[model samples]
Target: MPVVESTTRRTGGSTPHRAPGRATRPRRRQTSGLPWLLSLPALLLLAGILGYPLVRMVELSFQNMRLRELISGRPAPWVGLDNYTKVLSDTDFWAVVWRTVAFTVVAVIFTVVVGLGIALLMRRVARGVRLFMIVAMMFVWAMPQLVAAQAFRWITDSDFGVVNYVIDKLPGVDYQNHSWFVNPWQGWSVITTLVVWAGIPFIAITLNAGLTQVPKELVEAATVDGASPWQTLRSITLPILKPLLIIVTTLSVIWDFGLFTQNWVLRDGHPEPQYQTLATYSYTQAFGQSRYSLGSAISVITVLLMLGVMAFYIRQMFKIGEVD
Candidate 1:
């Protein structure tokens, strides 16, 4: 007992022993500074890529910079708001804006509606069929914008096109050698069709992912309560998926607004001036006519217009969310 008591006295009782050279660790103080420091590189990269061009565009918009001034050693003269005033006063520009809006609205509506339908159908399909559909959709979505436009052009060509041949086959219908691009409206229709076809795959895939997250138990409860399919969808499915739908629709609106490649390719050499969108118009002013400042102004205005549209959609989404 004396030996045990002597040993206990020499050693610390129930306390952790530290190494000879060890010291107590200090507590970490939480601050937002670390996160900001970590994000600094990403911020700089984004500024270099996006911010630089935007600043340059704004600066160019205010200056009288044409191809001639760029070619010569002369400095670009300040034009102030002349470019903006000219664009705003042009009736043709306003016409293009309205046409672009119409096309975008129609295309978004068609894309969302068709996509929702496809997503819903996918839920009921066999696993093998679903895989095949998904693969096919990916292929369509992967198709290059220019390639799709060119394919559509070939399909709708005035001479020896499949579309004309199909129309001619219908009784009392003669569409042989019919030119789809003969008028502005017809040309715009083809463009809209191409946009809708190309856009549907993405929306469908996104919605399908959203649909998978929906509660099957809730759906079963609705079915057990004798609710019709449409009733269940409107009262349950859509409400649950509102956030996703809003996001998809907003993206569609933005994409359709700045739709350039397909439209340009489809109407390569012969887009009617009245039917031209902001993108085509800006391209004409910039590359086609060498009026750099005017083009920059138009491009700036286009961005402002799109921002306004996005703001409206965001406001509406918030309102709906609050109501729910």
Candidate 2:
């Protein structure tokens, strides 16, 4: 005798017969949609703020948008790649590009090294180190850039600066009086000092968090295997820290590229500055001379640069993931 299939009754119709060949999986109930739903609001917010503005910026970059256009209420003429070509040919733009790259590289290296050392020191100390580090870092980082720049300017000023005064008092160290901002080298010195001061805290904070995640067991095991501290750090800590290092380095690159306030205040707004940066150059074009299109062009270039750096970072992450 053949087995009869079971039938179940429904609210609005006659019983439907069930095919009882085998038990089926519960439709693999998707949880991916749940996470997407949870994240949708944040994604929308990010698109609204960053994505929309960037789209508008790209659009405006291609157009000859200006005060005249705005005042006359005329549609901006699409210039295609004209602005970009002009910026590329400009000598001032190149100078700014060089200075910006140098500044970012130097500042990032200084910040990362100093921060890593500080984090290590903070980790070693058991008594009130946290409070001291937090207070010290916060003091420098919390100050307004303008205020810090002004204070530093006064401190490093040739005429009345305490630094020069102290130098003057010192025995036989080239006591030639000079304004620190008078030369390109001096300008970079001031800029680098400010960059290091502003950057070290972030590095220390990030590296310290990374250091915390490094397992004590791993360290002890390495020690038991006759690995020195430096060796252990090289072999294990650094490898484990790849992700955090990538994040820190990428952010540092982006931040340092757009360095403006410190450099500006260091030299106090010279239009034809000897040590111009792409950002400062763009600012001068837009605000100093009201050349909106040129400024927008510079900004578009910067966005491209940032995108390149971001792409490099993503590639590195993918490589690391594959290695893991």
Candidate 3:
């Protein structure tokens, strides 16, 4: 019996007297269950946050649903893509889309270029000076976008605007009554200015961080080889900063594309709404005209456009990562 028990323990860790047919190994349930188990919470959260809202939005966007429908609990009448077609056909909508694109491009250019200069400047400073510049930029970044717009409005105001007043008083300068709010292009200039100001901090902070990562060894090596300052920056520093440059540029485009407050606060929806970005166009349709379906369609289009831009950026990001 001892020999048999020892044999059983050595072979299968089972007693010799145990039922051979009935004895079973423990099964690993997680091997079968892990995917479903892990996905349960995410699926639940997605359903809770997105499922109904998206379905309802689609339904509403196809309907002539007004506040009356909410009051009566009646099924909203389906207009069957009228909202979409109308939104697409509107000249104003096209104008807004163009405006958004222009704003995004111009603002991104200035923000990235100016930000790169600032970042380069900060890179040469002592740690104390670097931190101070960063903190000051952080303050501007932290301010509300609307407040920034209003403050810019004050700065560009015809009479009280400090900038115009200063320009007017300068010798041989006939800056006379430069009503920024009146001219179409001049109004857009203010919008661009505010967007640029609001956007600089993002690119600066990002590029500054990028500058820190530029290999000192590579720069020194380049300098030792008789590379000029500009040459060193172009060949050595910029290559290292490329990834960050892409990110900062992409983000700035996305930010300025959705800008509404800068244009709106500048003129309070005046002058035939020439500078209305897509966001404000959607807002005007939804709230200003109480055209919920049309407005929702515009919202859907803007979202889709932004999504396209996001996909492009994501693809570029992956390319950068692969290169790295």
What tens digits encode model 1's per-residue C-alpha lDDT throughout 1-324?
A: 687667777885644568999898899976778899999999999999999999999999999998889999698999899999999999988988998899899999999999999999999999899889999999999999999999998898889689899989999998988988777778788888999999999999999999998999999999999999999999998998888898889989999999888778877655668557889889888888999999999999999988877897888778878876
Error of 3 at 42 (Å): 7.9
TM-score of each: 0.85, 0.81, 0.81
Estimate, for each residue in 1-324, the C-alpha lDDT of model 2 and write its tens digit: 122222323234455457888666678655668889999999999999999987887887788888889789999999999999999998877877887898899989888888888887877887597768868898888888899988888888777788888887778865446677667787688789888888888888788888998999999999999999899989988888878888788888988888888878867677347767888888888778777777888898998888999888788878878877
Clashes of each: 0, 0, 0
Cα error, residue 62 of model 2, in Å, equals: 2.3
Model 3 residue pairs with clashes: none
Evaluated at residue 12, the lDDT of candidate 1 is 54
Best by TM-score: 1
Q: List the candidates ranked by TM-score, beginning with the highest.
A: 1, 2, 3
Per-residue lDDT of 22-97 in model 3, one digit per residue for the tens? 9678997556777899999999999989988777777788999776776799988999989998888888888889
Error of 2 at 200 (Å): 0.5
- Provide the overall lDDT of each model, using Cα atoms, as 2-decimal numbers: 0.89, 0.82, 0.83
Worst lDDT 10-window in candidate 2:
1-10
TM accuracy, model 3: 0.81
| Worst lDDT 10-window in candidate 3 | 267-276
By lDDT: ranked, best first:
1, 3, 2
